[model samples]
Target: MIPVKISEEAIKEVRNIMENKNIPDGYGLRVGVRGGGGCSAAGMNYILGFDKPKNTDKTFEVDGIPVYIDKGHVMYVIGMEVRFHNGNDAKGFVFVNPEIEKELN
Candidate 1:
């Protein structure tokens, strides 16, 4: 089973961007954690970008969209859903991770 779920809208948007940008094959959307170092304790955050899977990356396909996630970040991203928001407050991809939300609450 796929580790994460990607919304159809999000997939469409990503595909459109990929076509417009002329991104080549072998490149996929990468979902990984960043920012755990430095003096300030801001904590880890998610990042999304077009990149090639690294040796330690785990790949998943959602609606034909290739997604690469670092092996170490699999736990944090598991069961998460990526959705596209066009609402007034936000107009981009949003990650819905129940586990993290519960922890934050």
Candidate 2:
């Protein structure tokens, strides 16, 4: 199983978004890496309301919320935690990844 972590605030935010947007059941978050933009190496991206698991993904469930991580990006995402941040400039889920710098450079 893929390693997964989710904060209480993140859970509340996700649930609120889902309810506000009228997203259907089974919708969850998909977090993974994509090879374009920002840094030369893989950068993280996420789909907030995802319905089905991608063919190349490994799944993890935390606090009744499903999170999908792509197989190719697994090594770069291990031990990462999902945090809810409400800073002055940005407000959303932030990925606390130990392998982020390694993946970037």
Candidate 3:
């Protein structure tokens, strides 16, 4: 199982993007943390691309979608739920990581 749970909406949206972009067969969704050194909270970033897993990377296949996550970032991402938003306020994947939320609380 993946370290995090992905919403059906998110999966559909990702697949739609892949089809539209004509991403190659092996390209997978990349998920990880960024911007902690200078920011109050670290934000999640997503990239639709291809890259081999590093020695310190953990790989997971969720609903036919391959996910590569760095070992160091796992703690922050585990148990999170990914959802896609296309409303007026937001228009992308939003991460609901309980770990970070609890920490900030």
Number of the candidate with higher TM-score, 1 or 2: 1
TM-score top scorer:
1
**Cα deviation of 46, candidate 2, in Å:** 6.6
Q: Residue 81 error for model 2, in Å?
A: 1.6
Provide the lDDT at 48 for model 3. 34
The lDDT ranking, best first, is 1, 3, 2
TM-score of 3: 0.74
The whole-model lDDT of each prediction reads: 0.82, 0.70, 0.75
lDDT of 3 by residue, 53-84 (tens): 67787899878888888887777677888888
Q: In the order shown, what is each candidate's alpha-carbon RMSD?
A: 3.5, 4.6, 3.8
Which of the two candidates, 1 or 3, achieves a greater TM-score against the reference?
A: 1
Worst window of 10 by summed lDDT in candidate 3:
39-48
Clashes of each: 0, 0, 0
* Residue-level lDDT for 102 in candidate 1: 92
**Candidate 1 deviant stretches above 4 angstroms:** 37-42, 99-105
Per-residue alpha-carbon lDDT of model 1 for 1-104, expressed as tens digits? Answer: 76777888999989988889987899999987787765432466778889987999988887677889989788766788888888988799988876778999
Q: Which ranking of candidates, highest TM-score first?
A: 1, 3, 2
Pairs with steric clashes in candidate 1: none
